[model samples]
Target chain A: MRLFHGQRAWVLQRLTALVVLLLLALTAATLLIGPAPSYERWHALATSAPGAVLIVIFFAALCGHAWVGVRDIVLDYIQPTALRLPLLALIAFILIAITLRVTLTMATHFTVGA
Target chain B: MPAPPRAAPKFLNLAQIRFPIGAIASIGHRISGVLLLISLPFLVLALERSLRSEADYAALGTWLNSPWRALLLVVMVWAATHHLLAGVRHMLMDIGIGSRLAQARMSAWSTIVAALLIALLAAMRWLS
Candidate 1:
């Protein structure tokens, strides 16, 4: 059975990948080039509205990219439909949960910090 | 004259194959992708803790500074760097920039070398 076939998944993977790459580089650069690492700075960056929103976007992209990547791998190595379907479903659940948790965490913090 | 029949190889032997540099980079991409996926929950846990409170942030920092986690971080840094570089290489190839064999091999080698160097830098920065 084709789990995540077609051009749409392929395009999703690449697009999400670019988003993740750019955001990660931005975050890394800010951490490295700015003042010494500290809890205050990190908290501020994470809780700021724009920062929090960007972070949420970053994680969303990450989950999307991961789902596609993992689905491809599972489809490739796992032969049995019984095993593969369950495995893909598990991964999908995990990614969705991660996305929700991150969004909630950022939302809570942003609201409190504002 | 009819050719003599020969039996086909029954099993594929992975050990006998020498992977090309590009193939090595390609596999590294998949491996690193999976590793990053496995580590995501823990990473998000850290992010949550770090944002929860100053005390929690400090606690998480201390935990990360420990020897074992430091090692794991090094591995993660390498994985992230390699995955990023190889992914960019793939994207460029998709756009027809590095589709040639020589250029592809060069990019693959560069990706691996650059990722290692960046990871080494992170290790020094963190472990020192």
Candidate 2:
């Protein structure tokens, strides 16, 4: 048998969820241990590859998950499929744009001064 | 009499539940969404506090375990589980795991059970 329900979207959601959980665990651990890291320490941590990867993956997954959820909400209550579809599209566009923007900001940390 | 018109029923057939598993799931998901919406500000404030200083962080730690905090935590727990369960349902639909009526019913029940178990644990943690 397949390891999962075998749908691509479902698998993607679960995979994203697993990534989110792992990231959240790391976040909780870091916070619970201490919140007094110096600005340089925190900045270094954020600029690290593992941190960047975690953050990018997190934003990506969060956008996808929230888009799916909001789309479902539209479907359930919008009453008109035509309207629902466009609303979902708009939401997807906005989420994707914002995520890309944030990712770009994260990318700036390692760059040499302009 | 040629015709008779009576008052329309005030309640939806949905309000009358013979078998309400699907409706229950839908309701739970919506409720979770609403709870998450309400709790977002509190959580954000907590997040902001924890980022400010050690004392602020300690305050958040204490706040997270308070009675109102526990209630909000339960809401978040419900939201997380409901959303997760709904995601699994979508996944199952895609994989053809439970297209049959019986199997779908079983899956729905499983979601509820799993959600309840998670909620119980989260509540316990909050209380403890």
Mark the regions of model 2 whose C-alpha exceeds 4 Å error after superposition.
A1-47, A79-114, B1-12, B17-19, B37-57
lDDT for each residue of candidate 1 in B1-128, tens digit (9 for 90 to 100): 77556874556787888889998898899999999999999989988888878899789767767877888898999999999989999999999998999999999999999989998998997788
lDDT of 2 by residue, B60-106 (tens): 55666578878777768878787668656856676797867777777
Point out where model 1 deviates above 4 Å.
Answer: A1-3, B1-11
Candidate 2 chain A, run of 10 with poorest lDDT: A2-11
Supply the DockQ value of model 2.
0.11
Model 2 Cα lDDT, one tens digit per residue, A2-84 = 42133564556567766766787787687447765654455556556776666677767766656555655775688886687
Compute each candidate's TM-score over C-alphas.
0.90, 0.60
RMSD of every prediction: 2.9, 7.6
Clashing pairs for model 2 are none
By DockQ, who's the top model here? 1
* Chain A TM value for model 1: 0.89
Every model: iRMSD: 0.9, 5.2
- Residue-level lDDT tens digits of model 1 in A1-60: 854569999999999999998888898898878665788788888788888998899989
